[model samples]
Target: MSAQDDVDDVGEFAALLRALKERTDRSYGSLARRLAMNTSTLHRYCAGEAVPVDFAPVERFAALCGATPEERLELHRRWLLAVAARRRPRTASAPEDEPDTAADPPPLPRRPWYRRRRVAVGLAAACALLATLASLSVLPDGRRPAADRAPTAGPLASGTTEAKAPDRSSPSPTPSDSPATEQPSASATPKKKPSPAPSARTTAPPRSGRKPAAVPLTWSANSQAWKLGCGHDYVIAKPPRQVPPPPAPQDAGTWAATQGAVHGGETLVELSVQGRSDTAVVLNALRVRVVGRTAPAPGNAYAMDQGCGGAVTPRSFDVNLDKDRPIAHAVAGSDTGVPIPAVRMPYRVSAEDPEVLLVTARTVTCDCLWYLELDWSSQGRRGTVRIDDAGHPFRTSGIKGLPQYTYDTLARQWTPDS
Candidate 1:
C-alpha cells in the first residue's frame, strides 16, 4: 500500500485505541496482554509510530475493544476505500498478439434502476436453477441447459438474454458477495469516565515564626503596563534624607539618641524582623516590582548592610530593589542646616494587614538646631518631627540613602525604610 494509505490507517488506529482506553480503565499493559501483543508494540500502535499502511491491526484493536460488529464492518469498508484511493493501475499497452493481461477486469457499467431490478430478477432465476441441479445429485451434471453451462457465462446465461428462468424447488443461500443484513450488537461493558491529569507547577515552602503559610508573590505579563499590589504601602520622603554615619560619643559613653523623619506620598517601604520575614518578602516581592516604577533620575542598583549586631535576635536584613535606590547624599544633599528633598521610593510589602505608606513631604533637616520639620504617614501609619539639627538628623536616618534603617536578626541583610 502507498504511504498516504498507511497514515490514514494509523490515524484510524490511534482513534480506536484512545476510544478503548477511555471506555476501559485498564492501562496499556492490561490492554496489550488482552490483545496477546507486546506492550511496546501496542504502545507504538496507539502512538501512531508503527507500521505505515495496514488497517488490519486497527480493526483488531477495535474488535478487542469490543466495538460493535457494525462498526467493525464499517471499518473494513473504509479500509477498502482507503486502499482503492491509493491504488494506481499500470497503463502500458499490451503486445498485439498476447492475450489481455490486465491485473483486474474492466469495471462493469452501472445499470439504470429498472435495468438493475431486471438483472437481479434474472440472477435469482439462475440461482434457482443451479440450486435445483445441486440438490438432484445429477453428478457432474452436463444435463443442465448449455446456456447455463457455458464456460464464460455467469448468473445471466449467454443465449437466454431475452428470457428469464422458471422457479425451482430448492432455494440457494444468498451470495457471500452481497452485503449482510445483521445489525451489530450493543457493547456489553458499562461506560467509564476519564480521570483528571496531574498539575505541573510546584507549591510554595513554609517560613519561620509565622502562623499561616507564606503567600509567594506572583507576576504576569499583559501588554506594556504592570500593576503592583503588596501587603503594605511604601513611603517616599519629601526630599530623600542624606545618609550619614552615627555621631561620636561626647561626654562619657551615653548611647546616641535615635532620631529620624518620614514622608507622606504615593510611595512606601516595608520593615520587618528576619526569620519570619523571608516568607512575606518572597510573597510580595513581585508586587513591589510592579508598582515601584517611578525610578530616580539616572537610577542605579545598590545594596547596603547595616549590621544590627547583638541588638536583634537575627543579625541582618536586606532589601529587594525592583530597580535601585538613589544615593541620598549625592541627590538630596546632606541633612545639616536644611533637609534636601527626599527621593520618592515606591515599594510594596506583604503582612497580616496591607497598607500604602509615603515618606517625605517638602524638605526635612538634620539637627544642630535640634529640630527638623517632617510628615510621615503614607505608610499606613503617621509620625511627625520638628527637630533643628540635634547636631545631626542625617546621622540617624541616612546610612544608605534611606530615611530609616533596620537590622534583620535572622537573615544577615540590611533593609532601609524610605
Candidate 2:
C-alpha cells in the first residue's frame, strides 16, 4: 500500500510511530527485541491496528528510535486524539424492519368523567381560597395590614412620653417621614446586605516561616551559544558525513535530542527562571550537584554551529565540573570586548519579570551527570529547587581527544571542524 493509504488506514499517531521507526533503519524484530515486546505487537502498534494502554511503551519506542523531544510531544498529542476517538461512541442505524418504539410517547391513562369533574371542582375551591387570603394580607398601597405587622414597643421609661399607635384610617407614612423603627416603603431603594464573614475552612492561612515542600520558582533549559561564535557541541555515534545538516537556532534542542546526542566538553545551558506567583522570589545561590561520574562515552563531537559571528552579554556563570564540589561563579561575558561585571546572585524574579542565568559547565576529566540546586526565598519561606533535564540529571562528557565535525554550508555536507 502507498504511504498515504497506510496513514489513512492506521491514523496519525500510528503513522508517526512508523515514520520514527523507519528513520532508525532497524528491522522491527531487532527494535522489538530491544524493547522487550512481541514483534507482532510492535507491528500492530505501527500499523495503527492497536494502541498501547499506556504512554510508557510509546515513549520508550520513540526514545529508542531517536525521536526528537518536539516529535515526541507531537506524538503524545496525536496519541491522545486517537485514544479519544477510539473511546467515542458510534451511532448505529436501526434495522428497517424494527418497530419505531420512540416515534410516539406512551398514551396516558384516562380518568372517568365523574372523577375528572370532582378534581376540577377541588382545584378551583383551593385557588379561590388562596386568592382571598392573599387579598386580605396586603393593603391597597402594598403595605401589610396593621394586624399582620409586628407590634411596635412603647417608649422606654426614662421620663420619655409613651408612643401612640398609628391610626388605622390614615395612609401609611412616606419613607422619609416614617419613624426609624418603621419598615421602609416598598418604592424606596432596598438596602444592600452586608457580606458574610469567611469561614475558617474557606480562608487561606497565612504563609508560615516553615519551608514548603516545593519551591515556587519555575525554570526551563535551552542550549545556548558559547564564546567565539561556537554553538553547542553534541557527541553522537554517527560519523560527520552521515549526520544531517545544522539545524536552525530554534530547532537546536530538537536536533540534538533526535541525534541521541550528549554534551561534549562544555555545555552552555540557559536557565529561564520565574516565580510561579506574582510574589517576587529572591535567588540566593546556585550549587552544582554531581549525581554520577564515569569515563566519557566514546563518540565523534559535532558542533551545531562553527565560525558564526556575534556576541551576547547576558547574566552568565561558569562551573568546572571536574571539581568534586563545583560552585557556579559569576563570570564576565566573553567576546564583548568591554569588561562586564559579573552578576552575582541575590536576584529577584516574579511572574511578570523573569531572570535568565547562562551557565557554562565544562569537564575535561570525566563524563559527569549533574544538576543544579537553586536556593530561593519568598514571603518568609526559603527552599531549594532541583534543576535538571526534565526529571533526569543533565549529562555532559569530556571530548578532549575526540574527532570533531561541523556542517559545511557550501559543500552541503558535514566536514571536520578546523
Candidate 3:
C-alpha cells in the first residue's frame, strides 16, 4: 500500500497491535473465538486494514495477549495517539504506490518548507441530516401499484386499503390501462421480522401489532451513515437521503493575539501579565496568542514566571487546540480541576480528560509578567489572530478584530463565544 494508505491503514497503534498478536503465539482464528469476533475482522485489526471505532476489541486483544500493566498502558497510549492521528489530515507526504524499476532513474529531491502556507480546514459542516422525501410509486391510473408499493403502515381489520398516490411526474394511465385487482386477503402471512443484531441501537418497533406504523428509522451509534435500518423487518421508511449542509467559514473559531507591529506576513498580538490585578489571562489557540515586545518567550509574555514558576511551561498544561473539542465541554468539570497532576509542577493532566488542564495558584509562586509569540490552530483554520490596540485591555476579551473569546478555567482553554 502507498504511504497515504499506510498512515490510515498502518498507523503506529495498529502496528503495535499486530506485533502483540504475533508475540501472543495464537492464530487469528483462536483469537477471534476468544474475543467473540469474526476471523476476518481479527485479521483486519492485525493487518491494520482498519481501526475498530470501538475500543472493546482492542482491550480484549490486549488482555488475551497477557499484556502487563505497563504494556497495557502503552497500548492505551498508542491507541489514543493512533486515534488522534487518524482524526488529523494525513496528506503529510505523497504516496508511493508503485516502485520504480532498477533500470529507472531516481526521483527528484524535495525541499522542506520554512514559513508554511495556511492549511485548509477539514470537512467543515459534515453533519448527519436526514431528508425523507415521499417516494411515491403509483400507476398512471389514480391507483397505487400493489406489488411495487411498500406495505402501508397501520393495517385495518380485513379488506385492503388505498395506497399512496403515484409520482406526479409519471403520465396518468387511462381506464384502458388500469389492471383489475382484488382486495388484500386477511389470511396473507405476515413476514417474520429478522431479530435485531447484537450491536444494533434499534428504534422503537412498528406501533404494536394492532396498528403497524412506519418503522421510525434511526442509525446506531456504532453504525455508519450507509448502514441505516439494518436487520429490521419490512423496512417501512427507506433509509433517509443525507443532505450536506452549506459551507461554514473556513477559519471559524481560530484566532491568535499578537503584540508586535503588523509589518507584513502573519498577524501578531501583544501579551502583558503584570501584578495579580493586571496580569493578562493566557488563552488557548482558539482564543488568543500573546506576543512580546523586544524578545520572545517560550510560553508567557516578556518577563516570564508570573505567579506561576519558571519550571512551569505551556507544555505542562494540557493543550487542546482541536476546534471540535470546545472548551465548554472541559468547563463542565469541577472548578477545583483534576487535582492529581498539580504536584508534578506547572500542571497535572488526566489521561482520561487530556483537554482538562489543572493548575493552582500554589504551584505558581513568582509574581512576574510574560510576553509570547504564540502559535496554534483550532478546528482546521490556522493563523495569527490580529487585533489592534484601541486602549482596550489586550486581555482575555480583546478588541473588535478578534471574536468574543472566553477562557475556561476548568478545561484551561479558550473558547470563541461568537
Candidate 4:
C-alpha cells in the first residue's frame, strides 16, 4: 500500500512494458494509443511519476507488454495500492465510519426533506453492508467466493444468501469499465497520425515503397551556369563502377584508417575514360572544366565503355554542355562535427570553367585522410582543360573557357592563373 512496498511492483510493470515494446518494435506513443490511454498518462506511469488509476489501463499496458494474465493481475494489484497510497491521507487510515472531508458534498435540498427519507435509509443500508463485508476474512488460501454468498448482504440476511445478476439495462457502472466498447466509431477508424507543422520534425515511418516528399531543392536551373542534359546521349545506359562496401567504422582509429583516397587521380581518369566508374565520370567532366580554364584542350568529350575498363570509346559530338542540374556545393573543410579526424574540402564549377565555387566540407575521420584536389592543363589545338583534384577530369574542348583562380600555396594566396 505504501510506495516502498509497491516499488518492486512498479519496476516489474515498467520492465514488462519495455519488453513488450521491444518485442513488437513499437514506440511508446504507438503502444499508448493501442492501450487506449493518453500517451502522457502511460509515460508517467512508466516513469513511476504517477500510478495508474485503474487496472483496465494497466491491463492493456500488460497486454502490450505481452504479460500473462496471472502476471497482469498481480501487477494490477500493486498498481492499485500505489495509486491508493498516493491518494491516501498523510496520516493513518481513518475509522471506517469517520466522516471523510474528501467525500462529495451532499445534494442540494431540491425536494422536501421528508420525501428523501427512504432514499437516505437505502444509502445507509448499502454503506452498512459494505462495512460488514470489509470485516470478513480474506482467506490465506485462495478460493472462489461461496456461490450463494451475497457480499453486500449483512448478518441481518438469513444464512441462505442468493447473488443477483446485474441489470443489463442499467448504464455501465463506470466510464473506465467500458472505454474501448464505448469509444466512438470515429475513434475506431485509424486516426491519421497528427503531422507536425511544416517546421516540425517528422518522426513517422514513410509508407511502404514510397519515400517522404523530399524537401524542395533550393538551388535551381536558373542558378546553374550550364544546361543539364537529358535523353539517350546523356543517359547512362550502363553503370561504370561498382560501389564498394563502406568499411565498418569501429572507432576513430578505424575511421581514420580509411582516410586515404580509394583510387588515385589517374585511376579515376582511367575509370572515366572506360566508363567503368559511376559517379567519378561525372566528376571527371568537372575536372575537365577546371583544367581547361588555363589552356586550350581538345573539345572532344569522351564517353566511357559499358564497363569501367581501360578501353575508351568515342561517342557522337554532343554540342551542348548540360549544367542545369542541381549540384551540392561545398565551401569549407574541417572535422568539427565529423566522427572521423580529418577535413574534407569540396569545390564545384558550373558546366564551364568560368563559374567555379569552393565548398568547405567536413570529412569524418575514418581510415583515411581523404583529400580532394583540383588542377588544370591545356592541350594545344584542343582548348582549356580543367581537372578537378577530386579525381574528376573535364574537357571544355569546344566551349570557351571561363576565367578561374588557382591556389598558389607558395604565395599563400589565390592567383588569377586562368
TM-score for predicted model 1 compared with the true structure = 0.19
Query: What value does the lDDT take at residue 161 in candidate 4?
Result: 12
Once fitted onto the true fold, the runs of candidate 2 whose alpha carbons sit more than 4 angstroms away are 1-214, 224-230, 334-336
The lDDT leader among the candidates is 2
Clashes of each: 62, 0, 19, 66
Give each model's whole-structure lDDT. Answer: 0.25, 0.52, 0.26, 0.25
Clash pairs for candidate 2: none
Model 2 misses residue 55 by how many Å? 37
**In candidate 3, what are the lDDT values of residues 282-401, reduced to their tens digit?**
223322222211111112111101111111112112212222221211122211122222212121112111121221000011111111112222233222211112101111111222
TM-score of each: 0.19, 0.48, 0.26, 0.22
TM-score computed on alpha carbons, candidate 4? 0.22
Model 2 weakest lDDT span, ten residues long? 153-162
lDDT per residue (tens digit) for residues 1-418 in model 1: 3445546754674565676667777888787666545565567556755331233345556766777867666554444343332222122333578443222212222222111110010111111111111111111111223223211100000000000111235343223311121211111011111111100111111123223222122111101000111011112222223322321111000111111111111111111111112233221111111111221211111122232111111111111232243211212322113333332322332322222111111112210001112222222332221111111111111112334443343554334544
Query: What is the lDDT ranking, best to worst?
Result: 2, 3, 1, 4
- lDDT preference between candidates 2 and 3, better one: 2
Model 2, position 318: C-alpha lDDT score: 89
| TM-score of candidate 3 against the unseen true structure | 0.26
Best by TM-score: 2
